[model samples]
Target: MDIFADFTQRINVAVQTVLTHYEAGDVDLSRVTVEPPRDESHGDLATNAAMVLAKPLGAKPRDLATRIAAKLARDPDVATAEVAGPGFINLRLHPGYWLKHLAGLLAEGSDYGRGAPTGRKVNVEYVSANPTGPMHVGHTRGAVVGDAIANLMAFSGDEVTKEYYINDAGEQVSVLARSVFLRYREALGEDIGEIPAGLYPGDYLVPVGQQLAERYGAALRGMDEAEWLPIVRDAAIDGMMAMIRDDLTKLGVNQDVFFSERTLHADNGGRIAEAIEDLRARGFVYQGTLPPPKGQLPEDWEDREQTLLRSTEVGDDVDRPLVKSDGRYTYFAADVAYFRDKYERGFNEMVYVLGADHGGYVKRLEAVARAVSQGAAHLDVVLCQLVKLFRDGEPVTMSKRAGNFVTLSDVVDEVGRDAVRFMMLFRKSDAPLDFDFKKVTEQSKDNPVFYVQYAHARCQSVFRQAEGAGLALPDFRALDAGALDALTDEGELALIRKLAAFPRLVQSAARAKEPHRVPFFLYDLAQGFHAQYNRGRDLTHLRFVNPDEASISLARLALVKGVATVIASGLALVGVDAPDEMR
Candidate 1:
């Protein structure tokens, strides 16, 4: 149950009662919120009912707060309600309420934080790396962020579709095809030395070259460039995409759809042309001339008139080109078609998980949504900042396998999947991250992944110890509230409060599109569990399993089990494993 939501309703009722008593009618109550107090010592919960309503009612803030507090003081669950500062009402809940909630949590088990259905179809497209080579560290953050957001949304009741847009129609993949051709010639014993400067120089293409040689051999060597380019291009894209898929699989990311950009360019750009025509029918497309870019000479500008989209009228910084003077559709036109395709597929929200460098694309993408959907759909772009890799405080830059950058596979292979996924989300997606190989693998509290996983393992360890001591837990399915009454310690109550906040946390994080909050909450919960465990060590009476006191032992064991279940549920949402034992 979402206690915050429950209290919000309770507090709103109190506000309505106060307003009616004062003959104040028809005031908007949406701004009133009940949340945890900023300072734990203040109270268990706090509300701003008076602060939001006093102005509308033309009453002093403190007077409204006193009335609201007095009304809330009558609640059986509220142990104390006091006005704080100018208008906030702080509440302390009775200990019995927490104990009963703990029992309910233990009953819910793995589904504790699962949300009700929202009925909104959300398409989260991320890691649309060019299909030219294996994924590098730059793409790793975007991949993890997207996957975690999708998982979070799915957990929080939205119907989420994970997708990848393959950049197969770009010039980079053409260079990749040519690079593979060079490797093919070399594999066939031709002295094709020194890869050209403009082509890819990575050694990963050697296998593709060998495969091409094994299939076509001398036949491709004699064919015209036009005849052989398509064959090699298709082969190279397939090879690279296979490698990319393997890398993603290793990192625990599996997309539900892999949309090919080449499809939009098929039949001589039919899809893009159709999208432009649709926009034209909506009066968003026009023939226009773009002014020369600032700080550039007029001679350096493409000053010719061209087919354009009136994107600025919608939301973009400026009107964007749709078709070039040469009659080819611009890249933005393809983006428009892609968005229309998603909108037609019934996605009410399209979330783009792009790299930080794609900041300029945000406004135009939003414009596309506004123009194409006519405000019927929403577009959100999350920009993930770059990850700087370090080893023992020193920068480690080069990767021999990827030729120029560290591949995502290399990072995963070095530190394992759990560490990579957890660390990628340890910080907000927009903030720069410094990932240290030595630090993440360290088995200490400073390492968040290790700390959280160890907390789960410790909970398991507690159960194992209980089993060895011949203390059979009471049937948790039939567990009673009386058993949980033994948990009256401040530390135990604090942990329960943290655990109770998960459902609300999931809803907020999912709505904000911030998957990093999951890891943050998990870390805090782990810290609380660890602290409570230490408390038990110093005080024998507070231990989880006491042979002499079966009642209290059963209660504490159930609490430990609840902690483990919540941690496991959270880790699974982020695609991280919570091990039963950590050695």
Candidate 2:
């Protein structure tokens, strides 16, 4: 249970009672929050109820705080409700309260941190890297962030769909098809010579070319460019997508939907055309000439009339063009159709996980969401910053198979999936990340993933040690408040306090669309567990497995189980494993 949330309600009641006693008018209590004291020495939980409500009620904060603390002090659960500073209420719960909650934590087990279900359907579209090649290192962070966000939302009780947008209808795939054709000729005993400047030079496509040669033989080569382009394009897109899916699987990202852009342009651009007509009907579409872009010279700007969206009416800085001068739909038009399709599919909340370079697309996409949903839906875009790889402080070299950039598989294969995922989320998505090869592989506390995983391994080792010592293990399911009667140490209570904060953390992280917070929480939790373990090493009374003293050992074992359960659950949300033993 979230003790902070429970106290938040109690604090609300205390504030209401004080207001009624004073006959003060109804005040907004929404701003009042109950959280742990930044410094644990202050108290267990702290609230700013009096400070938030004092000014509106025309009273001194400290005076109001005394009244609220008096009311809260009457509750049995609150051992002390002291007025701190100007108006904050610092609460310290009775030891009995934590013992009861520890029993509850053991009972809840894996479900301890799960949130109440909200009937909201969310669509998280991410890692929609073009299907022209394998996923590069540039795409790895977004993929990991997006996947973890989806997992986090699901764990927090929102029905989420993980999606990938395939840019198959774009010109890049056509270039891919041509590139593969060159390799196919090379596979068929032709000297294709050096790869042309505009074509992809990656040897990763060689297998696709060889497969095409094996499947179609000389049939494709005899046809005209138009006739063979579609066939080769289909084969190449299929091959590249297969490779992309494999790489995502290696990184543990399982997308539920792979929406193709080709679907948006099928039937003479029917979906895009329909989306434009819908906007026109809503009076958001217009015919106009955009002024020369701010950074572009007048002569470089096109002066022709064009079909455009009145995106500025929503929130975009400038109007967006829907149809280019060539009478074809622009990429932005495809994005519009895609948004419309998702909106039609009953998704009220859409999240886009794009690269940091796509910051310019944020306002336009929000404008599209506002216009297409008619202000009924919510849209969020999370832009992930670049990741620079290193090897012992030196910049890593590129992959020969990928021609220039490093592939996702390269990083995963070197450091393993858990290290890649945990490190990717170790920092905020918008902040730059520097990933080093050697450091992540180390097993010390300097490696956050290892530190966290080792905590779990240590917990298991405690139980194994008990078994080896012939001490009967406590039944976790049968544990209750009475079973924890011997846990009076301040250190033990502090650990319980940290475990009690998990539900609140999950709710806050999911609401904010920030999965990085999970790893941060796990790291701190591990540190606490490690510190407690070291304390046990110094003081025999705090040890978890005592062959002679069965009561305290069982109590400490229960605490160990609680730690392991939470660490495992948090790791699952982060898409990492909580191993029982570390190699």
Q: Tens digit of lDDT per residue, candidate 1, span 64-166?
A: 9999999999999999999999999999999888888888888888888888899999999999999899999989999999999999999989999999999
- What lDDT score is found at residue 17 in candidate 2? 86
Candidate 2 is scored at a TM of 0.98
List TM-score per model, in order. Answer: 0.98, 0.98
Off by over 4 Å in 2: 24-26, 297-301
Model 1, position 254, has a per-residue lDDT of 98
Runs of candidate 1 with Cα error greater than 4 angstroms are: 296-301
lDDT of every predicted structure (CA atoms)? 0.92, 0.93
